[model samples]
Target: MKSPINLEVVHKVIDVFRAQYKNRDLAAKTEKILFNLAATGHRVSEQNFRAIVGHIRNHDMMSPWFIVSNVNTGYWITKDEKELSAYLDQELNRMSNQFDNVSNLHKRLRHGKTKGTGNQASLF
Candidate 1:
């Protein structure tokens, strides 16, 4: 049977590096990283690599994820995932509570208005 293709090579390579370099403190160049990834039988295109690098820098690395860049060496690096899901869960709950509080305050402020005022307040 043919081997299944790697869909998200960049993410997979990052995870592998995270595990492989758990103890070592080293930043790898883009070429070195690509080589290492290739050694593991994963082929990544330059466009995909550049896109993933940009993505990691932007959007805070998939929201709660983080990748550290070695400015001097131009190497992409990260130490950990940092329990992103838990962080996002807490933020989500906090935002939900804030919205609820605002909704309650709005209701209280509008309590004195007409019962039929269920829509936006008209200026006309």
Candidate 2:
């Protein structure tokens, strides 16, 4: 599939993180990065930013980069062993919680505990 943002712009965003490597305090937030992109004449939305960043994190293999994002610290490139480990732990926890929620909903639906609301119909 084609990327939502241009390759050049993707590289630019990566470079922004790269420049802040190991500098946890310098992590840029999504809004700040989007603003920077807009200032540079790139028409990027928050969704586009998420899409490109998600792609880079999951698929980009040429660059040995790990983008660490946190609610408090924002986003930054990290090569530190400890920081990367923590990031992985955090992401895993988040994913686990998400899965748990989905599983709960599935169980509820299977047990017919929830009726369809409004115009929505139960798929089961």
Estimate candidate 1's alpha-carbon lDDT, on a 0 to 1 scale: 0.57
lDDT (10s digit) by residue, model 1, range 1-124? 5333344775776575565533225656567777777788876765666666666556454333344444354343443545334444665788888776677666777777875575542310
The Cα local distance difference test for each model comes to 0.57, 0.73
lDDT accuracy of residue 8 in candidate 2: 87
- Candidate 2 clashes between residue pairs 3 or more apart in a chain or in different chains: none
**Reference-based TM-score of each model:** 0.43, 0.76
Model 1 regions more than 4 Å off: 1-7, 21-24, 59-65, 79-124
Candidate 2 runs further than 4 Å off? 1-5, 20-22, 111-124
